[model samples]
Target: MAYTPELSNDQSRTLRRIAWALNMPMTKAMNAVFEYAGNIIDKKRVCAACKDNSKCNTCAFNQKRWSGSPHDHQKNKELCLLSLIKK
Candidate 1:
């Protein structure tokens, strides 16, 4: 897989710290941290804490529902099947 270049050393270090706090392996932590950062940056969403909000649309830690969407359900089911197959 091609590596995604990090925007800056500070960004990279912050992501690593987040990963460590979550107790994830380095690779998985890196991937998850970058993915969440990408969503926030690309979506132009405000930070949840800065907004003094419990949850925001782009917060990675949010656990809101993906309900009432057939496509979402289908995609989730497909991922589940793929994981099972891999196992």
Candidate 2:
């Protein structure tokens, strides 16, 4: 039942399921998924506007993080999901 030490409960569950389905060990499966995900997400900047703090006041991600509610931004959920990948 041991998964990657860095994995959270949800991550561990996903890795365990993948490992079981693939008949691989938990670490190996988690490594595989992590590698694939890193390759996909590493190139993505998530929030290009985040580099400009001026936009933070209007940024949906910031707004949601601050107030715990969706803001009136077009890409709020998309941006938030991208920013939440590893976290």
Local accuracy of candidate 2 as per-residue lDDT tens digits, 1-87: 356357689977977887776567886665555544533442225454346566555433443334432322324322222333455
Residue 19 miss distance in model 1 (angstroms): 1.3
Shift of residue 14 alpha carbon in model 1, Å? 0.1
In order of appearance, the predictions have TM-scores of 0.33, 0.39
Q: After superposition, how far is residue 9 of candidate 1 from its true place, in Å?
A: 1.5
Candidate 1: RMSD to truth: 11.3
- Note the Cα lDDT for every prediction shown: 0.46, 0.49
Compared with the true structure, model 2 gives a TM-score of: 0.39
**Can you write out model 1's per-residue Cα lDDT over 1-87, one digit (the tens) per residue?**
367564588876866675566666556666654444433342333334355454455444333532243224335321221221233
Clashing pairs in 2: none
Candidate whose lDDT is highest = 2
